[model samples]
Target: MNMSTELIGMVAGGVSTAAFLPQALRIWMTKNARDISLLTYCILGLGNVFWIIYGIEKSSLSLVFTNSFILITALVIVYMKYFIIKD
Candidate 1:
């Protein structure tokens, strides 16, 4: 990939990863996840795992990093929903 393309990827990845911040923060602060769909997040986290694997195979650092962050954020929400809040 060219420098411009790599930069684009990085920027896109950062934005995508940042998209989850608000929800995660809200759940953490409010300790309320009753409105969150556990199944949806589980599926999303699974998809992120597959994307991370694909990123590894393709040697795409942007994909791997972004998906990993998304996966972690999803897991955090899942944990808080299932364990912390039980909601």
Candidate 2:
């Protein structure tokens, strides 16, 4: 990949990855996820997992990195939805 394309990928990945930080931080701070949708996150997380596999198959670093971060964030949301809120 050219440096310009790689740079774009990194920038896009950074922005997309950052998208989950706020929600994760909110859940961490408030310890409340009652308003979050469990099924939505579950599906999103699963989708991220598939994206990771696709990234691996295609050898796309941007896809791997972005999807991996998204998957982590999605897992946190799902965990909060199922486990934390249940308590």
- TM-score for each of the candidates: 0.91, 0.85
Q: Give per-residue CA lDDT, model 1, range 10-33, as digits (tens).
A: 899999999998998999899888
lDDT of 1 at 84: 92
Question: What does each candidate score in C-alpha RMSD?
Answer: 1.2, 1.6
For candidate 2, give the lDDT of residue 71: 87
Query: TM-score winner among the candidates?
Result: 1
Candidate 2 off by > 4 Å: none
lDDT of 2 by residue, 44-68 (tens): 8888899889888977889889999
- In Å, residue 39's CA in model 1 sits off its true spot by 1.0
Assess the local accuracy of residue 24 in candidate 2 as a C-alpha lDDT between 0 and 100. 88
For lDDT, the strongest prediction is 1
